[model samples]
Every structure is written in C-alpha cells, then in structure tokens.
Target chain A: MRTPLCDRFGIEHPIFAFTPSEHVAAAVSRAGGLGVLGCVRFNDTDELERTLSWLDDNTDGKPYGVDIVMPMKVPTEGSSLDLGAMIPEEHRRFVDETLLKLGVPPLPEGEGREGVLGWLHSVARSHLDIALAHRPVLIANALGSPPVDVIEKCHEHGVAVAALAGAAKHATSHVANGVDIIVAQGYEAGGHTGEIASMVLTPDIVDAVGPDVPVLGAGGIGSGRQVAASLALGAQGVWTGSIWLGTEEYRSLSSSAGWETAFLRATSSDTVRSRVYTGKPARLLKTRWTEAWAQEGAPAPLPMPLQNLLVSDAHNRINASGDPDVVAMPVGQIVGRMNQVRPVAEVMAELVAGFDEAVAGLEKVRG
Target chain B: MRTPLCDRFGIEHPIFAFTPSEHVAAAVSRAGGLGVLGCVRFNDTDELERTLSWLDDNTDGKPYGVDIVMPMKVPTEGSSLDLGAMIPEEHRRFVDETLLKLGVPPLPEGEGREGVLGWLHSVARSHLDIALAHRPVLIANALGSPPVDVIEKCHEHGVAVAALAGAAKHATSHVANGVDIIVAQGYEAGGHTGEIASMVLTPDIVDAVGPDVPVLGAGGIGSGRQVAASLALGAQGVWTGSIWLGTEEYRSLSSSAGWETAFLRATSSDTVRSRVYTGKPARLLKTRWTEAWAQEGAPAPLPMPLQNLLVSDAHNRINASGDPDVVAMPVGQIVGRMNQVRPVAEVMAELVAGFDEAVAGLEKVRG
Candidate 1:
C-alpha cells in the first residue's frame, strides 16, 4: 500500500521494520519496505560499524534506517565495578539463584556478556555517527525525540529522523523537536511501550501532529490485514518489529536455540508487560524467568541499564542453556501469528497480498 | 457497511452499541445500529422489568439487545452480613480513610448501597428472565460463555447469544458451548478485559472461531475508520462501548455529575486497569481513588463480588460528590476521541460516513 511516506522514502510500501539483525534489515529493504536496524544490541561500536558496512554493500543500493535507544542515564566507561556496586546484594542473589533454579549453565569460554554499555546515550550517539557515515535514508530513536541538534545533524546528512511516541502529547513534542515521522507505539508493542493501544494511539497522534507528519501505527500488528488497519487509523504507514523475529534471515544470523521456538509456541495472551526485562515495562515472552520475577519473594526490578547489567549474565546463560521455555526475549502479543519460519521476501509478499484482500473485502460490504 | 450480521439481525449496519441507559439504546436502534442495553445496573427486578417494557414500547419497533454480567458466585438471599464479614477490617478502614481524604460525602438518606446484590448470578438470571419477557433480539454475557443451559434458554426464547472473549482459546470454548457470536474484547476495552489487545486478539479469535460464527471487534473503537479496521481484521461487526459515555441521550437520562465530564477530559492514557473497581481488572478513569488502591499500604483488592461489595458505598459517595477527576467509571482508551457530546443519530451517521471514507482511501492505495 502506497502512502505519501512511500514516495518520501523512495520505498514501494510504507512498512518500516525495526530489527537488530542486519540481514533481516537488508532483506526488508530489498522486499520493498524500509528496514530499520536497531543498534543497542551491538556489543562494540566496531562491530556495529562492520555490520552497517556489510548492509550498505548487500542491500542492492536500497535505502535502510538505523535505530538507537537513549538510556535514562549513561554509564561511564571502565565503571563496571561501580555499576555493580549500585545493585543490592539481595537482587543479585535472587538473579543468581533463579539461574541455578532454572538449571541454566554458565556460558562457554570467551563469550562476553552483552552488558549495559549499549544502553548509554553516548554509545547511541556513536551509533548515530557511524550510521550517518553510511548510506542510510532514515534514523529513529527508541526512547523519544532525539535532541533538536541531533535532528538537525541528521537533516544535514539528508536523512529524516523518526521518533516513537506512546501518547498524543509525546507525538506533539516529537513533532516540535523536528522529528520527521512519528511511530505511535502502543502498550501492546514489544520492548518499551506506553499504555494506549494502536487503534486509539495512531489516530490521536495523527490528529495531534497534523497531516504533514506521517504517523506509523505500531504494536500488535503482524498481518497485511493489520497493515491495512494501520492505514485506516489515519496512519500513513506501519512500524513493525516482532514479526521479523521469526524470519529465515534472522535465524541465519542469530542462535535459533530457544529464540525461534519461543515465538512459535506463543499465543497472544502469553506475553506480559513487565519491568524485569529492561528495567522498563516491555512486553516479553512469558517464561519461568518472568513468572519467577513476579513471585512474592522476588525483589522489585532495578531501574534501567542497571537492571540489564545485573541480568546480562543470566540472560546469556539462559540463551546458552538452549531451553525454549525459559529464554528471555522481547516480543509482542502478535506472537500468536508468528507460527512459521519463512523467508523475509515471502512474508513481505503475504503482507502486501493480505492488505489487498482486506481492502477488497471491505469493498464488498460498501453497499 | 453491510456485513452478513446485518442481514442475520435485520439491521442497517454491523455496529453494535452497548449502553446502560435505555433511552440511549432506543436512540441507537432508531439510528440503524444494534443498541444493547446493559441490565446489571437495575437494582430491582421490577425496575428492570419496567425498563425492558419501556424498551419494548419504544425503539420505534426496531430491534434491541440486553447484556448481563454473570458473577462468579451467586449471593444467597439475606446474606449481606455474611458477605460483609468476608472483607477484612483493615481493608474496610482503608476505604473509609480514602473517602475522607478525598472529601467524598456519603449518599443521601434512604438511598441504599446498591450492595453486592447486582453482582450476584441470581440477579443476572432475573435480569435475563425479564429481558426474555421483552422483545430483545440478542442477549450477551459480559463474562465468558454463559452456562450451556443459559445459552439453550436464550435460544429457546428465540434470542441469539453473544459472549465477550479476550483470548483465542476462550473464543473457541465459547463456540464449543454454542455461543452464536464472539466479541473479542481486548485489554483496551473498558471492563473486565484480557491482556491481549484488539489488534492481535481480533484476528486470532477470528481465525480460531472460523467464519461461520460472527466475531465483533471490541475495545478502543469509537470512529468509523476503526470500525473499518475491525472489519479488515476479520470481525463481522464492531462492539462499541466507551463512546456512549459522552452521548447526548445518556446525559439526558442520567445526571451529568462527573460521569460525562470525566470521559470528555480524558487523553487515552488517563485510564488504568485496576481490580478495585469490580474485584476484576477493569479499565477505568484513573483517579486518586483508583490510585490509592495501588499505593504501598493499601490492602490488596478482594476477589469478585467482595471488591464490588467493599466499594459500593464508596462508589455511591464518589458519584454523588460530583467531582469529575475522581469519578469511578468503566471506559475504554477510545475516551480520548469522545471530545464532543453528540446525539446517537449523529454519531451513527458519522460512523457510517467515516467508514465510507476509510474504505475509499484504501482504494486509492491499491495501485
């Protein structure tokens, strides 16, 4: 489905997918949608730089985007011990005991824990610098609107800046800060989200930001029919994330051990929004880890960055354990529909076709 | 827009409007949509019988429906004292202190608490009996699928049975229990909702229940574009509730006292799902009253009828106090869109026109 955003971004459709894997991002761009690569998962700035360089060569010259998360507080370099001191003894003990209870084993030799360093704004700014040096068409910040100077810098690089807003007021603030696009992320979304659902949030942001600004409907959208529904809610496009986790390209790069199976077995009701994941309320696959955190004796989740740092080892061990039922991953309620592992190209075709059928079906009812 | 449901119900459109006021119900039916009057509010059997008689006489000979909430446990006759004893003294004291802190005065003399009686299953059964004596074309249960005998009883009375479901498995179970229609009520819904959102839940339930059974998309639906989006997600019709809170007809039948004003001022995020309202997590206008229940020292909300029983007097006091910011009412996220108070006729016409525009707009993107 073509919207004004399609022409502006020089893409075939207005589907903007947020993913961490460069392969998935490149495939989305090749499939006629904009692929936004999330940078916070990068353990090293050099690793992210090399990945972007690879995406630049492999996307067939098609435009893609990069996403960064600006943490509430930045961590000073070489301060791991200091950060560790911030966590309580009980909270650390609880996490370690939880790993032991779950029968999770330690990571193999030389495998470093992907701790909270990527969550720092300073690291995200370096990601922006590396992204700008590449041939990307758009940039998005996960937390909110990037600083006005950051928006202006992206503008100077001939790139558009997009921001995710969970409320109408936030959308207005993002627009005022020179954000070119607003992704109305609802409470049903994976990762960090606010309380409004996409059905209400999209139209509210669309009205609040006015018609000149394109709003992409996010949260709980998986099908082409949902893509059409997004456009129906006054959004000019759709900002998708969770569906990409089940793609063949993603499995090719990442460990399929517990990740893909977790999504395949999930129902819409299986995901829960909890602060235990990222020290912020993010929808994640419900598992023994999440259930244990909700138990009466469990300590309250530590604030962001620190929470991630405390549990990074546990998450790494859980991933290494290769148990499908207890591995932690951020996913949306739309996991119910991601039952199959398919190529990104096949998934993209189905979405477009589904949109076509949905629109045509509505026509039959327009008496 | 004419779905198969329109022909089955002999209605002009597939919009099903739920309201507690019969006047608003009649107006919605007159405006060519199905108006389902909520029956749980009537305190006495005679009062409910008389209201249904009025609906039978009015509605201009058009069809209408009735909704009942089948509580978890039926309260025996003359057991108020036993139920009162079930609540802890500390919880009772907390409620009293919160009321005093908010300056909510007691209700006028001779005006009763409305107590846990209405939440009793026997009361709901009486509501159903009176409803069947009237001419309602449909009967809906707010909880899960009604007992098989209850569904059979409605069928014997020549009325269709509709049940609200928040998950796909629930929809399937309802269908197995012979529920004629399924209302996929998502977390964004006003009262007693599941964690799944309408965007993902609608399609999942639609696929689960199959095409033969009509599925109504509920939660955060206020405009015609949203109705179209619901259809795109494969709902045969839309089950709308929150938008009716700010309607002209409802305002005429009931006192405006804080009720309509609370909805008019809300911004989507001004609501929370708390068990304090009904002992079940129902989305309500977030207020100091609701906020207090969530604070540290506040006692945990009691289950089911106990929670409603504990707060009945307090609810009465708060409603009578006429404070817009502190009123406890069930409303969906769509309250953000209900900025203007309009007649049912105008709202229905706008929904129809909006649906036309949305469907047409999608046609433009088909190329």
Candidate 2:
C-alpha cells in the first residue's frame, strides 16, 4: 500500500486523516497514517501549543500535520472588531430570530464559544506560528491558497505546505504560490468547498499542475475503494475528513454537544451546501438552523468573517443546548457511510484492507 | 486497453462515443469503439430507420448503439398537440421577442429544421422502436432511466439497456428497474444533467449499483487520462459526448449552423448550465441567448416539453441565421480541450494511446 507519499511522510499508508480531536490524530499517526490536526478549533496559543506538544509526545515522533483555515481573500479586513462592526444589523437580527424560532435555548453562563477566533486571519497566523514550532511534517490551509509568506515560512522550517483547492485553476495558483501539496477537495467535502466534485477535480488538478506536484483527493471519500479511485485519478494519496467524525474518538467529543447520534443517523442526502454556516458553501447536516437560512426571503448570508460572527452565538447556544435537531454540524455526504463508531486504529486497518482489496480487484479486471 | 466492456460490445476499446452524426457513429465503430447514434434528432421513424440501416451497412459488422432522450419524467405528459397548447402566451412571446432582440434571421425557404422532434416522448418512442428493429447492441436513455416496458422490450431483443443518472440513488433505482448499465453523468457533462459533478457521482453510482453492474463514467471527460481516471473509479467504460462535438464529422454538420468556429475557440470555462435550450439544466456554450435568459427578471424557463416547444422556433431561427454569438450549442467543459478538428479514427487512436500512457504513468507511481 506504500507509495512515494507514504515514504515522503514516513507513514505506513498514504491515507491522511484530518480531525479536530488530538486523540484521533495521535491514533491515526500511531497506526502508520499521517494524522492532521485541524488548528481552527484552538483560540488560545497556549492551548494549541499544549495540544501539539501532547501529540508530539504521544505519537513517539511519527509524522503528523496541522490544518489551518487561512483563506487567501476574506470578506472582512482589519482587526476582528472592525469586521464585527461591518456586519449588518439586519443579518444579526435574522440569525437571532431564526434561532429563536427554532426553539434553540441560550448557552449556560460562563461557557464561552470555542474556536471563534480561528475565523480571523490574525488568530490563524498565531496558530500557524505555533504549528511550525512543533516540528510538524506538513501545514495545510483548509480554505484556499496559503499566503506567500506562510508557504515560504513552512518551506523554511522544512515543512511541506498544502492548500485545498476545489478547481484546477485554484490548484494551479496554489502551485504557483509555492504550495508543496494540493488537496483537490470536491463539492461533497465537508466545510468550505467549490462547485467541482472530487473525481473530476483531482484529475483536473493533477493535469493542471503536472505530476511533479502531488495532489491529494478529498471530498466524499470514506473507504478503501474511494482511496483506490483517487490514486487511479493520479492523486498521490487521499485526504479524508468526515469519516473520522463518526469514529469513537470524535463521538467522545461530539457526545457533549449531543451530535454523535445525529451523525450516526444521517445519510448521504442529509447534508446540504449552505452559506449560512460560514458565508461560503459548506456541506453540513440539514438542521433547523440550515433550513431557516435557506427559507425564502431569509436575509442573505454575509460574507466570510461577518457571517461567521453572526452565527457564532447561535452555534454555541445550539451546541450547549444539546439539541440534535438544531445543532450545526459540518459534515460530508460520506456521513452516510459512517454508520458505526469504531476506534481510529480499527478504521485505519479497515482502510488499508479495503484499499488492498480494491487494487487487487482492479488488477483482476485488467487481467 | 480492453476490458470486459470491450468484449461485451466486441470493440477494441472501452470508449463509447455519443454523437448525432451517423458518419461519426459509423467511423467510431469501425475504429473499434462503440458508436452510439443520438436518435433525438430523428423525429421521423423512417429517417431514423434509414440512418441505422446505413450505419449497419457501413461499419463492417462493428457494434453500435442507439441513444434516445426518454426522461423518466417530463413536465407535460399528454400528446404533443395537447402539451403544445399548455405553453403560455407570454412564454411564447418572450422567446420570439428575445430572438428579435438578438437580430437572428429567419430560416431560408425549404430549409426545414432538423432534430426538433427529439423533445417529444412520442417521437422518441418511434425512434426507439426503429432502433430495436435494426439489431443495435445497446439502447441508452440519454436523460433518465428507461421506462420498465422499454427495458423489457430491449431485453426481449437481446439489446443491453443503459440509463443515465446523476446521483447514486438514481443509479440504484435504475438498476432495480433492470437497467443493464449505468451511465453516471455529472454536472460538467453536456445536455441535461444533475447538480452532482462527474467525479463524485461516478463513484457514488458505482458503489450504489455495486460491482456486479457495470457503470460508465460520463461528463467533462475528453482525453485518455480521464479514461484512466474513470477506470480507476471502477467504471467499466466512459460514455463521451462533448468531445465528439468538435470532431471533423460534427464540424461538417456544425459549419452550416455557424457553430463550428465557436466550438473550436471555446475554453473550459466558456460553458454554463442553463435551461434556455431544452428547459433542462444542460451545460452549453455561454452565448448571448443563454446569457439573456440568465439575466435578472428573465422569465424562469418553463418545464421540459413546454420549454422545448416555446424555444423550438427561436432555436430554429438562431441556427438558420448562422450567427456564432446567439446559437444555442450544447457542450461541456471539455470543449476547452477540443481546440481543433480531427477525424473520428484519429480521435479514437489518441484515446487508446492516452489511456495506455496514463495507465503506464500510474504503474510508475505505484512502483
């Protein structure tokens, strides 16, 4: 199952798992696949530093990466306060009204929103700086092309920089901007994505950037067959996110928010791409919150930071309320395949086995 | 370069070319790929029968298929005249006024419009009956799943029945209804398509239908590498349409409509999915006609048969005028790759060589 990517990252497999749980990340790395920790959840530098240190210690020096949401262009500029002020009152009122209409209760006192600071570029840079200090093997920008300075800084630190692109042109631009890897994310991918799907986009990116730059196929991928499909499309490896969300490690974090049940009950059709989540098209479970935003005459979602700010309180309250029906959970269509909550190591083993079987199946067909 | 699909159809390559040109269809079959003649253009049963007979005689015993647009559901269900009366006066007027605004001239006397009867189910059924009589190896529904009776009849005649689906569920339903093959068509594909792009949809359909049923990857595929990608995704073959539009055989037909030059010059981004042509979400060259209907306050395109009926005259006039900017030319993003005119034999040769090159490339990476 080893490819050049596996050797380059010193991993047992070329499967790269992106997750917010440090336990999951550590498990994936320990299981011989690169575990990429999503840094967008950390608001405090100390906390992020602690987590990376913990990962370093727990993984026994296995290769892992950090993922940050640093979009090349944001709707809001200046400080967080400036961006906050720019959000229209109408938009704020709509969010409040929608949540109220959905019967979502407010959060308990003394519990602040987690990861709100990650939407701001200033905060993301801090997270990036902390990640670089941890001797990580790779740094990936989750939204768009990484800034020139960020890419240069990662290269300077002997870290490979990856940027997620939904189109061939974006991959081209990322390669031109010195991104070391291109994650060709499809429309079916969780979080922010473009209109292109992974199957076409991976090969398109591969063709656009040529073979020199490795492309990792991401989107609705959650199995060994999909991984084989990605490699067949000329991707060096597969980058998966949603499959981990339903694993045992994620359920532990999600149980507190009362989302584990929702994740398990969901099907592929349960997800929708809506801008209400982050002012960009992100696939998430179709909850009341998403439904409200999609209603006719609903106030248009503000772009980027503004939209993120408008919904932050509502998201936090919904999560605190522990109400599955109204909670906002970013997921992919592959959530349909996430029917069981297994350990990270078990999931990794299944992936390896599935990939081998799929390759063998293809070989049989060729024969 | 051959798979079970090739052996099943007795072809040298697993490439299936969907074209409206009889010349191209015969050429592709003679060149060792299955040539599927698009029958939507032949409203007259006698004309269609003659064309199929011609193809049968010209291809030297090579296998070919017939493609008919029998959408699983249509907006208007009644007879042609009954559906024609349902088109609103305003919608009819809008089409006429839009054509006038575009300075499109009328058709020359005695030069009748070709292929306009394809939108009618009544006409498509006639075409299908004629195709079955001619001993076609396969019969494909270009828009949706074939009706149960249609599938049964095809099976009775020993013809393989194929249906186009844009979603996994659709493919599953088609398979349940006895579709012999699933053509997973993506949004980037020309003609009526769904929101799902080819990349995600193909694997989704492949998985939904399982390995026992062969799935053909369709949409923005134009080259050997894309063929390799499709095979990687577990598709038995690739069903291509847009790439054939720029071939020499199509140019001979398109030159009269003044679209040959436009097709040759288009970039990948030049196509848009608009309902202006067939009242369906079909990807087409972004001309003034498509742009006008897309403008704010443009009448929302009516449903299928009615929409097709309303625009029929305008489509006829636009083509007659021989104007490049206003002609409603259906195409896919692969149009960008079709930079020059080439013979069908040359195109087929390139696909074979490209497929080999791509497979070799993957082998090198795996090693």
Candidate 3:
C-alpha cells in the first residue's frame, strides 16, 4: 500500500478518507491512512476550532487534513445573512412548498440552525483561517482551485494545498496556481463535481499536471479494488468520502442523521446528481427531496450560495425529522457497496487487503 | 504490452481498435492489434460479407473481429419497416425542421443513403449472421449483453463474444450470459453509454464480474498513458474507437465522409452526451447540430430505435453536406487529443511506446 504519496504525506497507506465527522477523521488517521475533515458543515469559526481541537487531541499524533468548499468564483458576495437575502423569493417558496407537501415537520421550539454557510466565500475564508490555526498537515479545496494567496498561505504554514479537479484543464490550472495535490474527482463523487468520470479524469489530470504533482483519484471508490484501480489510473492515492459516511465512527457521531439504514439499502443506481443541496451538481442518494426538485415544472435551482442558503434550513429540518424518504445526504454511487456499518479501522483494513488482492490479480494478468 | 487477452486473441499488443472503415480495420489487424470492423454501417448481409471479405483479403493472415449494435432490448418489434412506421409524424417533422434550420443540404439527386439501421434488432441479427459466416476471431455487441443464442452461436464458431457495459450490474449480466470479454465503457465514451465514468466503471465492473472475466477499459482513452491507466484499473486490454477516426488509413477509406478535419479541430471539452443521435446517451462532438437540439424549445428525443429511425435520413443529409460544424460524429472526449493524423501503424507504434513509458513511470512512483 506504500507509494510516494504515502511517504510524502507521512501516512502508512495511501488511502485518504474525507468526512464531515471529527470522530471518523481522527479514527482514519489513527488507523494509518490520512483522514480529511470536511469543513462545509462547520458554520462558524468557534465550531470549526472545537472540531480541530477534538481531532488534534484524538488522533494520537497521526497526520490528517481539512477540506473546505472554496470555489474560484462564488455566485454572490456578502455576509451569510445578505446571501440569504439574495435567494429569490420564488426559490424559497418552492423549497417551502415542496417540503410542506412532503409532510416535513418544523424543528422543535428554539432549535434554530446556525453555522458559517460553508459555500459562502467569506465563510470559506474563515474556514481556511481556522484550519491554518490548527495542526492539519494539508488543506483541500472541494469545488475548484484555491485562490493563489490561499495556496501561498498554506505553503507558508508548511501545509500542502489540494484542489479537487474534475477535468484535465482544471488540474493544470490548479498546478499552475501552486496546488500541491490535485484530487481528480469524477461525476460519481459526492458534493460538487464535473461531467467527467474518475477513471478518465485521474489519468487525464495526472498527464496534464505531469508526474511531479500528486494526483488523488476520487468518486465511486469504496473498496480496496477501487483503490488499486485509482493507483492504476496514475493516482498517487484514492480520495474517498461516501465510504466513511457508513462507517461505525460516523454513525456514532452526535451529528449522525440516522441515514445509515437508507445508505445500506441503496444500490449503485440509487444516487443522482442533483443541485437541491448547493446549487451545484453533486451526487446524492435519490430521495423525495431530490425527486421533487427534479419534477417537471419544478423551480430551477439557484446557483451556489443562494441555493445553499435556501436549502440550508430545509436540509436541517429533513435530517432532524429523520424521514428516510426526504432526508437529503450527499453520497456517491459507491453507496451501493456500503452494505454494512463497520468501524473506521475495519474499513481501512479491508481497503488495504482488497487493494493487495487486486494488485496481485493484475500481476497474474501481466504475467 | 503482452497480456492473457492478447494471447487469447493472438494479437501482438492488447489494443483493440474499432472502426467502421474496412481499410482502417484491416490496417490495424495488419499492424499487430485486433482490428474490429463495425458492422452497423453495413445495411445488409451482402454489404457486411463484402466488407469482411475485403478485410480478409487485406490483412494477410492476421485475425480481425466484428462489432455490431445488438442492444438486449429494442424500442419496437417487427421488421425495420414496422419500426419506421412506429416513428411519429411530429418526431419526423422535428428532425426535418432541425436539419432544415441547420442548412444541412440533402444528398445529390438520385443518390440515396444506404446502411443497416444499426438500432434495428432484425438488422443486427442479420449482421451477426453475416459476421459469423466469415472468420472473425471475435464478435462484440456494441450495447448491452449479447443474447444467449448470440453468445452460444459465437462460441459455436470459436469466436469470442464481447459486450460493452457501463455499470457493474450490466457487466455482471454480460458475464452471466457467457460473454468472453466485457468492455467497461465510461460516460466519456462515444456511441451509447451510461452516466458512470471509465475510471469508476472499469474497476467497478472488473470487481463485480471477478478476475476470470477479462475486462477491457474503454472511453476517453487515446494515449499510451491512458492505456497504462486502463491496465492499472484491472482491464486486460484497452478498447479504443475515437482515436481510430483520425488515422490516415481511415481518412483514405472510400467510405470516409470527410469528418477527419472536424475531429482534429475539436478539444476534449468539445464533446457531450446527448440523445439526439440514437435516443440513448452517447458522446458526440459539440457542434451546431447538437447545440440546436439542446435549445429550450427543442423536442425531447424519442426512445432507442425510434430516435434512430427519425434521425437516419437527417444524419445522411448532414454527413453529405460535409459541413464540419453540423456533422453528428460519435466521438469520445479524447477527440481533443487527436490533433494530428497519422498512419495506423504509426499510431499503433506510439501507443505501444507510450504504454511502456507509462508503465515505467508507474514503477518510479511505486519505488
């Protein structure tokens, strides 16, 4: 499992797990693979700082990274409140009507949702600032290439900056902007993604950026065989996100939305790229919410921060309601493989073992 | 470049080139790789037999194969004329209007378009019968799993049956149906394809169907590095199509429609998956014709053979016009990399060299 990327990142294996839960992140790092904490769920600097502190205290000195949603250009610019205001009234009404029609109940009294809407540029910068204050070994931008200054600032901190690129051109631009790592995310990946698939995107990005920069293959990757395939595609490692969501560590997290059962029941065809969450194309488990948004005559989703703002409350409500039919969760097509909930350590072990078997099989074919 | 698949097919390299032109197909077979003659363009059994004869005469003693569009399911039943009758007048009118708006001139007076309407099940069966009569070493179904009788018939002729699958389940079904080779195609592939990208689909299918079933990686593969990546993804060989379009041998073919210039000028991003061609998701060059169908008021494409029937006449007109911007050529995203035209032998040599370099590069990364 050891490759140049593993040695470069000081991790025992090249498997990089991306998750929103601090517990899963620390657990993955403790298990010898790099665990990247997704910062999009952190709505404020204080919450993010607490999460980082928790990770630092729990990982037993193993290296981990932080992932933030920082696109090259955002649809709107202002405070979270101002961005909320920019969301069209019709869009807001549509969200409300759709949820009401779905029989989604309101939150308990005084249980208002609050956080640094991660898609907002201001919030993303705040996340970067808080992440820099922590001891993370790397910082990854989810949507696109990080701004030049962000990359420079990370370099100054002796922390590497990784950007998710869905195309070769995007990877080339990331490398030109001094990005240390390029995560070639395919259309099957959760969160924002491009039309390109990971199989082609990984090699395409690796070729575009040359061999000097490390490329991590992401999207629809759950098993060790997939990890082996990623390495075969010229990726230094595999960047996995959806696989962690079904792990025991993630399930035990306080923020767990109780959608593990839904994930367990999903097939590869259960996922769809819908813009209901962030006004961007993201693969998610097909649910009533996604279906409603896709219905004919449904209001078109607003771009970026506006859509995020409009749906932020609805997302919270849906999760809080624990309605399996309407709970919106970002997941990849690999959700089909997450049939059971296992400890993060066990998942890591299986990934390594599967990778070994796949490699051994390929070796036999080569012979 | 030697693998078990190459030995099974008795080819020098693991590259399988699929082309509609007999000249290009024969050239590839003569160049040490298995050249698969696409039989979709052959309207009748006589034409297919003649093309196969031409290939047999030109390739010396080298082995070649045949590729036909035999989807497991057809939109309509009965003969080709019955399927043609099922096409609605509105759909026919839309196609005529769309082509008229694009200024796609009809073929010269008394010059009628000819070819097997590949989507027709009857036509495909006739193609299969013709191909089996010849001595093709392999028979590849372009869509879905080949019928049990089709696979059994191929086995009877000592011809390996290969089918293209875009998902793990599709591959599994193909293997269960006794397909000898599973061509795991990604979204970036030309012709009909699914939403999964090659990066994920190849590995997913490879894992699902197990090691005994040899998987050939397809879609967005043009360079030696891509071939290396395909091997890494657990594919025994790489199945390529769009790359062959730019070869000098194809350009010199008597059947060449002069679309080589369009392919050479296109970039990777210049391709999109649209249903305009065959009522199925297929990657095609983004041209005025595709853009026209994408407009807001454009009619939704019909299903399968119906769409094929409606557009067959329009397609003939567009190709006859030789207007590069309106030609509906099925191509992969890798068309961007086909910037120069070269002899099939030269292209084959570069692929082998590029694959060797890529393997050596991966070895460096492993060290």
What CA RMSD would you report for each candidate? 1.7, 2.7, 2.7
**lDDT by residue for model 3 (B61-144), tens:** 899999988877544576667777878887778778888888987778987664247667878888898888888999999987
Best by TM-score: 1
lDDT of 3 at A68: 89
lDDT of 2 by residue, B95-213 (tens): 77888899987677876454377778778888888898896999999877877888899999999999999888888999898999999898778888887666557777887888789
Candidate 1 residue-wise lDDT, B169-247, digit = tens: 9899989988999999988999889888899889999999888999999998999889989999999999999888778
Q: What is the Å distance of residue B342 in model 3 from its true position?
A: 2.4
Across residues A91-142, which tens digit of lDDT does each residue of candidate 2 receive? 8888778878988877768875543778788889999999988879999898
* Candidate 1: regions farther than 4 A off: A71-78, A114-116, B71-78
**Candidate 1 per-residue lDDT over residues A147-224, each given as its tens digit:** 778899999999999999999998898898899999999888998998899888888898999989989999988899
- Which residue pairs come into collision in candidate 1? none
Off by over 4 Å in 3: A2-4, A74-76, A254-257, B73-86, B114-116, B176-178, B254-258, B363-367
Full candidate order by lDDT, most accurate first: 1, 3, 2
Candidate 3: the clashing residue pairs are A43-A115, A43-A116, A199-B199, B43-B115, B43-B116
True contacts kept of 3: 0.33
Higher-scoring candidate on lDDT, 1 or 2: 1
Which portions of model 2 show Cα errors greater than 4 Å?
Answer: A73-81, A112-115, A255-258, B73-82, B100-103, B108-115, B256-258, B321-324, B364-367
